[model samples]
Target: MENERNEDPTDWDQIGFIISSKYRTAVLEQLVDGPSIPSSIASRTSLPITHVSRALRSLRERSLVELLVSKEKRKGRIYGVTEEGKRLWERIEAEGMVD
Candidate 1:
């Protein structure tokens, strides 16, 4: 079901899917300022760490976010919006999709 949705590749559908989740939208909003690890995003968004992690995974699957750094260890993984993500985010903001 999720794989089917990911295969669509339509910008509107992608944007709609992203904005549909508050957690995902919050994470993207936070990333707009700069790259951040999950903890930082969780703190800023006031969402739990686990929720943040899940949101990151979903965003990554959609190619709207990328992991900037990943060590052999579990910590210090950084994430930022991709170029396509930046453009879509701008549209999301410009069109006032978020409250």
Candidate 2:
């Protein structure tokens, strides 16, 4: 659903969906800075690899993040934020949702 209209970061539903989960917020926050592998994300976010992987999966399903490498390669798969993700992040920042 990458083409879906999530242009409004001010959308309360979308904002609530994101801030409701710390893992999702942290994962998205990390990716917004740049692309990185899951392990690196886990390390930087200080979260477990399992949590990072789950967050990535959820974010991918929402079109907020995407797989940047060959999915079949398995290990060291890279992920980056979508334009929509950046928009959401901007709103989250503006609202001071996270520390």
Top-TM-score candidate index: 1
Compared with the true structure, all predictions reach lDDT values of 0.89, 0.88
Error of 1 at 93 (Å): 0.8
Candidate that would win on lDDT: 1
Question: Cα RMSD (Å) per model?
Answer: 6.1, 5.5
State the lDDT of candidate 2 residue by residue for 41-97, as single tens digits. 999989999999998998898888999999898998999999988888898899899
Kindly provide the TM-score of model 1 when superposed on the true structure, using C-alpha atoms.
0.86
